[model samples]
Target: MVGVKANTAAKFRLYPTADQAERLVSWSHTCRAVWNIALAQRVWAYGSAQRKTLQAGEQCSELTLARKEHVWLRDLPAQCAQQVLRQLDAAYENFWNPEHPARSPQYKRKSHQQGVTFPGQAVQIRKVSRRMAHVRLPKLGWVRFRLSRPIEGTVRNATIKRDGLGWHVAFGVHRPEPVDRHVNAGPAAGVDVGIACSVFVSTENEGRQRPDTLTAGEKQRLRGLERRMARQLTFAKKHNGGKYSKRLRRTIAQIAVLKARQARRRADWNHKLTDDLAKSHGIVAVEDLKVSNMLRSAKGTVAQPGTNVKQKAGLNRSIADQGWFEIRRQLGYKTRRYGGELVAVAPHGTSQTCARCGTRDSENRQGCGRLFACVHCGHTEHADRNAAINILDRALSTAGRAGCAASGRGTAQSTRSPHGQGSLAGSRMREPSSNVTAA
Candidate 1:
């Protein structure tokens, strides 16, 4: 028996008519209500051992009874509403599983419940033209969307999600990744992600640097807009019933626009960069950086306030703008599809560790310096570039181990997918890992 590979997703912008948009919004509200109601029911059930383990099917039956009493519940699509209960059940399972570090189920706020999933079998997509397509929902009928890319594989499921800009549809499909052994067939290289430059790539011949996502002018505008939005928020809170002023609303919209633009630019850059790397490298290595942990707020409680909170906040913003995690993720899938392999190496001492010599010392590097002057080996190199070199060596070593393991020799195996999504089953990715236990 042959096992099927996992499906990947592609997102596209949706353009619904005014009437369709209003209907979609109403559906979302109903879905949110259902999620909140189901969550409350579960929370209340925990009080009595008799009903503590209420199943999703039981809640779904209850929903059907409620719909009979209130036909308004039946106004929306049945399957979409039922998916809320399914999601709630999954949430509970995740919370209870010790291995899965997922948060317990919480009530969904209207602001956050902005997406709905539709089973692919229940919907149909038709390509209208080269740059146009239409998808049909249960009640919403046919909705138009910009077809930026062709739908290549069989669609498994589709989700409609509203972002800062507008609505988008993401389709999950199992498309075979085209492999080319000739692309990036050269020796493995290393990539270092940092603040000064988003990516510093080192090859056998030379190293290259990719600049930060935002320009100087854009950074200044972002700071100014953020400051303005803060002021607006404060002013809005002073009004009756905390009603936001027009200025506040306008400021928020403006901020959203800027953020959307930033997101687009960053996505574009990452896609191009990853594609190039996958097309060119036989093997690549990158640092396993915990972007979320690294960007955590430094400000603590009033009793024990954190030091350099403001400085840390700024650094967090800069690091987030780089989208290190996204790069790693894109690289994961791209490298695998493009006939290359990607491995992650620990980033602990890559910068300070002399690339030329096996030396690891904190004092080998100095403050706010890009030039790495190793004290022990008397080696000089760009800090990020040197780090890339070290990463490449580690990646090569990992690949060699995997190769040996395949031949029944090495003790360890590498299991990480080039797509960076961890396991096809969707597991949390950790760093300082050699990806032992190859798939």
Candidate 2:
């Protein structure tokens, strides 16, 4: 592997005093205001008769004069406010890039949670005990936080944000990539992600489901809260001029709490699963899925009405809950960190192609059943497992014989490196021995 810089973040729970918390919230609001004002200025400049364009440098110069004139702008940290302008610059850059998917920058709503970022030089960290630490910010001095883990690299910057849970701080750190780790000699595995089973492994011959993060009662309560919120929103739109009442705000907070819990659980599971896979496998192959495309709205135009809209909606929800994109994201960095390789193969017809016989027929996957019976070759296997094997074979074939040898699965037949290597003569499929353990 080539030498490269490794950048990561260390996040910790912040414990701020009541006054400090209030101040932090005010700073967030100031940041949001700066962003909105700068965006508005850019829009106006673009629409002017001269068609003048405003960049961050010119806007920042204007901000400097405004800060001297306005006490409110002067109260916020100058660096923090500058960071907001930089972020706005980035947003515009992304929007202008043809390859970037971001849309034009928009005004920030009061409900949106915008945070403040300070340069590393302005922030200082001091460890007071084994479990607690203190960080000094521009305005907030020596705020305490839980020392969940040791900071492993030089701090590049720190961001302070408020979520449904509470205020938190994240430090961006930079470190040199490790150069002395042992070469990966573990077996290679292919993974299939699906709605029914969160993941299936070709080498392990098993499928695993994500354990329910929320209890049945909690889920029921969440549904009730959602329905109530909908009713409240309708009433507010009709009678209250579309303004959210205090009760509506409280309900929104409650929903945020539940959703945050679910997100944390899913993130935790993904981290553990990816860590294990990275450490155990020399090569990990998964389908390169375009989740956004898969989750596209099923509601067609009135003139061209779609079929099975309800069924597609349910499927979309299931796929989203599985967090396939998150899993792939974690695998990408974890593999690099663990001295392993991550391969993403095209997903076309993986489920329909038989891993054993190389047959491509829709009938191979019959009627949503778990079993996959190849119509042409009379081979049978778990549908997900079959797809996983195909994914691995595609990866191995693409990587050529070098990858096959590294995985310790190298054989004369496997070295041929055909497109469907899983169906190569002498290739054997392992039988399912046990269920995959949940993370």
lDDT comparing candidate 2 with the true structure: 0.77
Q: How many backbone clashes does candidate 1 have?
A: 10
List the global CA lDDT of all models. 0.72, 0.77
lDDT of 2 by residue, 308-417 (tens): 99999999998888888778767766665676777878899999999988979998888998999999989999999999999999988887648544543322221112
Across 1-439, the per-residue lDDT of candidate 1 in tens digits comes to 0223225777899999999888778878888888888888888888676767777789878888888887768887777777677768767776786544357888878657378776555667877787888887888888998889877765655678876699988875555544433344455668888877567888633444455456888788888989998877777677646687887777777777777777888888888988888777767688877676898999999999999999999999888777787788777766656656778778789988999996988887899788899999799888888889999888667668446223321221133332223322211111111111111
Tell me, by TM-score, which candidate is best: 2
Q: Which residue runs of candidate 2 sit more than 4 Å off their true CA positions?
A: 1-6, 43-54, 92-106, 302-305, 401-439
How good is model 2 by TM-score?
0.85
TM-score of each: 0.82, 0.85
Tell me the deviation in Å of residue 154 in model 1.
1.1
Instruction: Please report how far candidate 1 places residue 290 from its true position, in Å.
Output: 2.6
